[model samples]
Target: MATKEIRSWAYDELIRSPFALPQGMLGRLAGRLMLWLNDPGELVTLIGKADSVLEVGCGPGGLLRNIQAKRVCGIDPSPDMLRQAARHNRGRDVELRLGTASDTGCPDGGFDVVVSVNNVAMWPDLEAGIHELRRVTRPRGRLLIAWHSATGRSPIARKNALPEEKLARIDHALGEPTRRYELKNLTVLEKHCQR
Candidate 1:
């Protein structure tokens, strides 16, 4: 199978269905590993006291748990992942919902910032997803999208890395990023909403 096809299959079979992702235990373990691998606190710098924040494809709500904001919302396609996130953030003021990156089911201009970490590769329609994120963000609000870097030379990193073409498309769609940097094994891109 082609690389794109494999990625599509992996996303459909594993990411979209968190319960069946190498079985439940392994899936949970992977989510925990992602939490450890990516520092959710790194996102706070870009947020900078934003009153409202939204995270798309927030698997297990790991990043959402770390963000300090007046209102925080997380959305993911997998009900199993949402259940896990709810359990993890039981006492936190987080709104977890079942939704996709391309269609978040949020109001237009609803949030001060929108973030998606390690989630872009799984977006079935990457362009539409970017537009959806822009739609939900208020003008001049920040948007941060990040993923594990292929430069990490780890199997997981290589598997999760966004294709070069996809990355270019995202950069073009967002215009010029205000900041692009690497944090440990992750690559981040930040931009302000112009619409």
Candidate 2:
């Protein structure tokens, strides 16, 4: 099979059984490794103090814990991951749900800010995911999409990296972004809604 296909299959398997693949200690270590690799603080900084925030592909609820929003919701394809997120975010105002990026099952214009960090590459359909993100964001809301590039040449980084053309297409679909910038190994795409 092709490399992308292999990666996708692996991702699918992981989503289906995140707790069993790497096994016991190894799985715990791998989860921690992922947590260390994904830091969405920069994305949260851009979010400011939104009333409601939705995070697509939120693994373990790291970003949800940091965000100072009145309401926070996190969606991910892995039930195991969501369970971990629920555990990590105990006593916090957060909701964890099982959903993919393209079909979050959130209400229309329900969030003041929508974010996806380090999860775009795993999206089954990128354009459809973008549309879904836009659909759930309120008019004049903020959208923040970000990814990490300094993953020590990991296959996941290579698989998930957005090409220039794909980035352009995402920008086109979202309309002009309010700001686009890169910090350290992180690249962020932000847009302010007009709809």
TM-scores for candidates 1 onward, in order: 0.81, 0.79
lDDT of 2 at 77: 71
Q: Which lDDT value does model 2 have at 179?
A: 74
Q: How far off is residue 67 in model 1, in Å? A: 0.7
How accurate locally is residue 46 in candidate 1, as Cα lDDT from 0 to 100?
Answer: 56
Query: Which stretches of candidate 1 lie above 4 Å from their native place?
Result: 1-26, 152-155
Cα lDDT, all candidates: 0.75, 0.72
lDDT of each residue in 68-87, candidate 2, tens digit only:
88889999776656776788
Question: What value does the lDDT take at residue 15 in candidate 1?
Answer: 45
Worst 10 residues of 2 by lDDT: 1-10
Runs with alpha carbons beyond 4 Å of true place in candidate 2: 1-28, 150-160
In candidate 1 the C-alpha lDDT for residue 100 amounts to 83
Residue 13 lDDT in model 1?
58
